[model samples]
Target chain A: MSSNSKDKDNRRRRRSSSLMYQEPPESLEQQSDQAVLPNLNAQWVNAKGAWLIHIIIILLLKIVYDIVPSVTQETSWTLVNITYMFGSYLMFHWVRGIPFEFNAGAYDNLNMWEQIDNEDQYTPAKKFLLAVPICLFLVSTHYTHYDLAYFMINFLATLAVVVPKLPALHRMRLAFLNPEPQPTDQ
Target chain B: MNSSNIGTELPPTAVAFIESAAASFQKIPGSAIVIRYIRSSYQNDPIRSLVELFLFIFAVRYLLAPAYSTKKTKNVHLTEDEIDELVEDWTPEPLAGEQSEWEKLENDRIPVIIGPAAPKTKLQNGRTVTNLASYNHYNFASNPELTAKAVNTVRTYGVGPCSPPGFYGTQDVHMKSEADIAAHLGMPACIIYAQSFSTISSVIPAFSKRGDIIVADKAVNYPIRKGLQISRSTVRWYDHNDMEDLERVLAKVVKEGQGKPLTRRFIVTEGLFENTGDVVNLPKLVELKFKYKFRLILDETWSYGTMGRTGKGVTEHQHVDPNNVDMIIGGLAGCMSSGGGFCASTEEIVEHQRLSAAAYTFSAALPALLATTASETVTILQEEPSIIQNLRENIRAMRAQLDPRSDWVICTSSPENPVMLLVLKEQVVKDRGFSRQEQEFLLQDCVDECLANGVLITRLKSMPPALGSSPRDQEKEWLPRPALKVCVTTGLSKKETEKAGIVIRHAITAVMKGKKWQR
Candidate 1:
């Protein structure tokens, strides 16, 4: 009985050791340590850079607005506004890491890798990036009786980016806005 | 485009045919009073109403396109090479099965489903047959004494609350349940909803308006999307689980609304992804919410009764402050083994929703038995910690047994949650291509096999991609990544777990062997 017990113990030890030596299962902890942290640093840099560009573009637009005192012309003013809106939207995407392909059907692919690798770490960032195309599409096309295909494409693009991000943002906002009170004696 | 021509072009025979067809259609099959009422209201202006009706139908069809077109099937007429290529692209074997003594031992296992009813037996010809599908009244984990106390309260209180909360519907039991949930969640107040489905569909749009922006997860439940559609709120979707995408959307919304008036901005998420079984990072999500200044709403339907040390849900599991969440919605259907939904929030928010939310104001209040049962379940969950431990053990055992062979079988994991995804063998997929009808058949077949081996399972279909009005051919077909979602309730036992594992293994192995079952 002693010998059998010793043999079982040895087998268990051997199994555990073998498992330790083998590669660990792919997990969020390990993946976040590698991909999410490093990617976050890159994203932060991009965000700062994009913010800088946004400031510069706003300054340039201010200059244009200042020089064009006759800004009441509907056509030219609309053109200027469009350019500014497009630039601001692009800057948002640059910071947020919006995928180039904005089709709603393919939106799942946009954050597929992040969700698989490190869901918690990447979910918020993906949610933020989804807003760029949607805001642009909505503001740009609100007045137009465009082709059905054009309207549908924009609608799809907006939904693709908006739907996924809304949930994450919702949770984040809820947390920030409604901080639990620290217990204190009156 | 002529006004007369638009209503014209109907021959006398065609008109007669239409009249006859409409009459027969009303008599045939099943027709609801609501449908007949709506149809009769539009009968006066037939031509104009017909066009409007067709348009409305088209819009409804488009909105629900994802649910409609998700079923794809393999063409039987395809050439061998084409079939081979299609199979190779769409479905591939994730793991190879091993034939061993252990496998053989597992093949004979049987599982039983337990519930509130008595065990049933059947007679086959002249012989007595023992029924294995007896899972009614399997509340071994539930304290009978506690259940009795709750039932006594319910019996004394009567059956249902009957009216919406806005009316004279708020009973003492309902108030107590709400208070209990709020205290457990550590939130200021709680609001009860008839169902979690209505809670999301109603409350979300109530908080925001047309000009307001809503950013949500693409994989949110369908009812939420339907609510957003009716609200006409400009929605921006971020990639699932991508925090960067969320920040970008926030910045864009803020930036774009600089000159224009921006209304309320809201963000929504699920506590634990019901489909993938993935946990959301509550702390990080909170941080983003603070930075963005958008109201956050989390649906903790799947997580409330299963996650955390105390089963308060992801907020507790992640060690985040529950009070940090603006609104926390959860359903008491699965884990509580009862029915009803509760939203934990501030008193002001609860009051506002009770007053403004249409569903909350209109829907019938929860039945008394369910409220009593759920409240009792909560008390049991809080007092008896070992139930969670046993569930965890069952989850761990199942994972350890299944993960090694995940390649041969398709299994998706989400930490220690009771839910797990079981992917069927590639041969099953080859036999049943991506068609919705075929997928349903495959699911039914799998359930049958499991039942034959004495295991019961709840089957679910995946949320399809949103598609708008388009011709059938033009509409993008979303294929469900076929999986069997396994959920372990408090009623499951160690013996039941082992038996279920064996039964599941046998069902999977039998299917892999290409053994056909009668439909």
Candidate 2:
């Protein structure tokens, strides 16, 4: 009976140790390390690029408005208007990649996941919150009717480009701020 | 003959057969209420049952009796001389270079009915014009010459096709007209149909089947929506200019339909939204089509002969190669001074549609004279670039005048193309002297006022679906807002633009003043 009890005890002990080994270790050290290693500079660069494009658009509108009044004759004004409008449109296509949203596959990778983890360390909601003001500003500009309806439409169209990137940007910041808890074998 | 001989040899059972037939006929009640009420007084409502009985009797006697051929025929043999006389009386001489005999008779006898005539003082004043509600003669103001031209062409072509396109109806002019359109569009082939609505309804269904998926803009033409509904295909609506929505829907389609084959994936959209008067992002749409591998169909109804460097369409305007777009469907109704639609595509698509599209195969082709007019118009549009330039200038001038008055007006998009919407406020709506029934009446009034002052404008009624609101709900809410869409054709002059501006401003001022005075 003692030998049989001993065998039972050994089998139980073996199963417990195997389960322990299979469980992933909980390490605060790794979590802290990941949280601290976010690429803040790259995030700022993207944000700056977005703002730069916005400024460039506003500048272009100003340039067109200034130049249009100087042109003499209705025919020349019409020509200049068409040229500026088409030019701006082409410039928009060149600068912002024609306002197309990126496919999910473009961001579906381990690097993106790591970026998201790092991003979480910063204010996760910052990008989305920022987009709200940008959208409102665009809507207001559209309502103001500066540079005709095309400018307003172009401004509204930027939302399509900006909105999709917000989640990715937010997730990147979140990933940097908050690392997910590791599994524990209790 | 054998059956008749067999019947004659049979024993005389006529009385028995007639009795049996009579018994069977009696089983079906002459009046249905008799059967229902007689079955049970307590089971059914007597009044309801009586109405149903009356309906049943009426249906049987009138509707069913017509199919049974109850009329008896008595044959009367006529001699050859009598037949020749009959033929002579029936055949009337053709009314060459003049009104038909029937039309002449109708014209002579028109005072058969009369209503309360216009006030005598107003009629006498001439300035206070009592006949303000007539559009037939309004053509005199818009384009008196156009009326003369139309009449001359009708006189030349005669009345109608008299037969469908398949049977001695495809005129040489029709073929040549479509060929000319194809050459102008730089498309390999084209098929012109009577109307755009019919063309879309017929061709869209012919292209795809139940197994296919049609990805269209949420704001496409109503006929296309109806066609997709009839096609019984999976229809996915991408958000307006939202490529991400399209991509997501495409991905889902691909995932769900992994191994199973689909017939076709068609993406349909307009080159320019006729209602909003905004140019579509065709290049972006084409780019998505290329990336997602779907066939694209563009309705360049509003854009043709108006947009692009060569007046090709939005595709040409955006510098997108037309070869990439699978099919281009366009209408020559508004700017082209013609009344028909054409589908410009490869020879294969044209052949497929010709064989399958009910609109093309069943409807009568455009009459010879109208086809000639369209052909002439195309030549004019292609050869005379100044027409388009003048149109562009007029558009710019109008926009420049209207834009500064931001409170009262808002131009949606694109001055290059000559469609503008004059959006009015709630107060302006009240000022137009229109009831809710005449929601379009205000715009019509503006048009009339414009015509009275010597500027012609064509107005469009916004479809309920395109308004992006349910009609029932909108009606209940008393949202009577309507926009006046002015489509400037190629012939609009600089003087006309200035005159139009003055007239539009005056109309708005008058309405506003009228409303205030009424209050």
Candidate 3:
């Protein structure tokens, strides 16, 4: 017992002398919380506002599409398709967040919102559930007259906000991706 | 306000001009004359005849456009990249050593020190700090009678009762104050504790225990949250002020309990939420309590001496019977103008708290002086019932002076509430491109301006900003800072109450207009 105690004391002395610091592990919530912009919770500064601005732009285009009448035909379909694609790219690339619930035909991803900020990794199948809302919305535009393309454009634009959240989806880190995981000591 | 008073201070000439203008303005209208035509049309027909009379709406809407648009009111709209820039600009310096700032505070005096609750507390330099953003509502702190009682009791009892309530600490004064509270609450018995925060913190754990479940508001005060923590029970937080959400949560609790033979459930809420300055819907809360068959523990920490016919609290204010609530928890530290807290319930529940409440069994008793102070203040409430009206009137005047839907300012609290919180609209904060610190600093500057101009206001402290926030999205880092809290007392005059709104508004606009954020 005496020998063991001395050994323990010597080990402590050496460890203390080394002066090496061991940082605490950050919680999944903390890690995910720092991974993106915090302002997404509020207005204007977060992905919500960016999404809103894109949505507004699409709405304004809908007014033009309605007024011009030329864009509604199959010929202007290319124009609408191009606009929707670009809108989707801008939204998914620029915005950094998504709404709590993105509703589909008979399904809702409401419960997934709380888990989004957790470091609990998700798959493409789970992340693909986010695209359902736009698919459903675009279908509605086909039956309606108010430039259904706007809804598709608006929905696709906000996709960038949620895509980075899933680890498997985001790429090209140098292009503007937040760090994967920092040391988190601070 | 009438068209009759428009021309030559009489309607006859005005009516003639309006009739003639209405008949001819249509022919005179061209491209640039649209507004003139509308005006001429409005003046000619006065009431726009019978059919198109409301065409004047265009003119009014056009005039009100600047005041109504959120975009027009806001000055800053940072792009996503700009937001990332600000968030990354100046990160909080992380400490080098192992000890955190909170741990260091335990060993050292706070950079800012607080005096005992008073009308005008002395600051570090012995300067009078009237309202450097204090929302303490401790009106009786510096009262001559209360202060004298404290002095006399300090000389006699020597500050502390020196024993727990279970021991020799139950003095005559303690019994008297408890009795006074019981009488005031219209309950069978009341138990007092060493401090106000501990009352709820101890009661929840003592009553609910580990296996029980507690349904609470998401925005309850910290003490209540701490109590919920101590209970170690499954806590379900309903959206703040949303009865529907509460019902949904309670229904789920009932469903969960259906499978269990014996389960304890409790609903906790505050009579007046301190953070939001809004009163809870007591009638709806009581209805839910019966519908769910869960016991209710209502914390009246802020509402106790500020509501009801004679400050009997939300029970009387909302006409809910005291018997409906299973337990009433209150803190005397604020508004009641004393230290310590009390739990009022039936004899059995009160006995359970006295026997098992950790704060009561382990903590020193409340000083005899504070017990007397509380009893004395209750008497003051009885003697002067009009003081409640005075406070209500001051709040009403303050609200009346500011447009409720103005884009410039937003009030989180209702007009009737004595504790009013006014914040710049979120859009306004975004427009100014003010960071969280910049916003707080600007609010402080506004308060200082108000103080210099002889009116004092306070900006509430927001939750500490999260460390390691995203530097990439600068706008995403802009936290919605807490609103300024301005509390009214019976001592406040009607004129000052009216002036308070103008003072606050002017101070905010002046501060916003004077300087620009560096980065």
lDDT winner among the candidates?
3
How far is B145's C-alpha from truth in model 1 (Å)? 3.2
> Candidate 3's residue-wise lDDT over A58-87, tens digit each?
456545565775555432433444565455
Clashes of each: 69, 18, 14
- Model 2 per-residue lDDT tens digits across residues B148-227: 66567678766557666777677777889889988988889999888767777777777775447788877676666767
Q: Which model is ahead, 2 or 3, in terms of DockQ?
A: 3
1 versus 2: better TM-score goes to: 1
Local accuracy of candidate 1 as per-residue lDDT tens digits, A102-166: 11111111233233213342233342333333334433343333344544544554444344333
User: Fraction of the real A/B interface contacts present in each candidate?
Assistant: 0.00, 0.00, 0.00
Cα displacement (angstroms), candidate 1, residue B89, comes to 49
What tens-digit string does per-residue lDDT give for candidate 3 at B1-519? Answer: 264555645557776888787778656747346654445434333322222322224223333433211112356989999999999997786576467554463234222336764445455645654442443443566577878877887788777778998999998889999999889878889999889988998899887753467899977877887788666566888888899999999998788676443557999999988777789999999999998899999998878888887887889899999889999988787778778999899999999888778899999999888888888888887778887787788777777765463446677775556777777778877776766656666666666667656556676653333455455543533333367778775544677567767777677667666755323
Provide the lowest-lDDT 10-residue window in model 3 chain B: B63-72
Model 2 C-alpha RMSD to native: 36.2
Which regions of candidate 3 fall more than 4 Å away from where they truly are?
A1-186, B1-138, B402-407, B430-438, B452-454, B462-481, B517-519
Per-residue lDDT, model 3, residue A130, is: 38
What's the candidate order when arranged by decreasing lDDT? 3, 1, 2
Cα-based lDDT for every prediction: 0.59, 0.57, 0.64
Q: Candidate 1: which stretches are off by over 4 Å?
A: A1-186, B1-143, B424-440, B462-480, B515-519
Top candidate (TM-score): 3
